[model samples]
Target: MASRWIRPEVYPLFAAMGVAMGICGFQLIRNITTNPEVSVNKARRASGVVENFEEGVKYADHRLRKYVRNRSPEIMPSINSFFSNPERSN
Candidate 1:
């Protein structure tokens, strides 16, 4: 009898990993397609509008501050102070 290269016990593990990867890939595709921000950024990059780390950080900070301001008024002062002087907070 010829012996199989892969053991039978490992088949379930491989299948589970494959399923997890597929789910992750599907979620990534969904996000890329559904999010207008992502598409806009891609278009900007294609048009030679290069995005650097500092710009990305500033954008994220702006978005975070806006979200925090809307959802929780009490935390606005702390968030504002932190952004104003990030070095002291850390």
Candidate 2:
């Protein structure tokens, strides 16, 4: 029967590659956390848009509600029964 273990020569190569990848990952995380240019909040504030996550969500919800309200009366019945009565003609 043949041995299923990896060859010993490949272990050092794998170790070296792992060390290099670890160093790169550490540098990437350091750059992201310390760099203001990568920050979403900073970018939004710089553009004079003071809305936070909650406010942005609220605005989106308001807009969606307004659009649905305006269009519902005209389109609601068909939308509601689209799946319920799939046999109905288009």
Candidate 3:
């Protein structure tokens, strides 16, 4: 009787949602456990917050600056330069 209301075609959608929810739940638990900002005690939390903030700033600066400096401005450089020096087919 329960199966009558739930169509077979909808099973995959339910499975996908379950997997997505599971992944989200796992990440939340991992972050709560491992993140320094969420310290076990109040005293440590303050220090952790400051230290993590500095680390985050440095990391962001290095990653963003490096990528911006090194990456090509063109969207598809190779394709864009295809006809730049075309060879005569004769």
Return the top candidate by lDDT: 3
Off by over 4 Å in 2: 1-5, 40-90
lDDT of 2 by residue, 22-88 (tens): 9999868855664433454665547763436764555346545876766646556867788678789
lDDT of 3 by residue, 1-90 (tens): 888879999999999999999999986885576554556777776664365676455544664587788787888777667756456321
Candidate models: Cα lDDT each: 0.69, 0.65, 0.70
lDDT of 2: 0.65
Q: Is candidate 1 or candidate 2 better by lDDT?
A: 1
TM-score of 1: 0.39
CA shift of 41, model 2, Å: 4.2
RMSD of each: 12.7, 14.1, 6.6
Worst 10 residues of 2 by lDDT: 31-40
How high is the lDDT of residue 67 in model 1?
A: 71
**Candidate 2 residue pairs in clash (backbone atoms < 3 Å):** none
- C-alpha displacement of 20 in model 1, angstroms? 0.2
lDDT for model 3, please: 0.70
Question: Which of the numbered candidates is closest to the native, going by highest TM-score?
Answer: 3
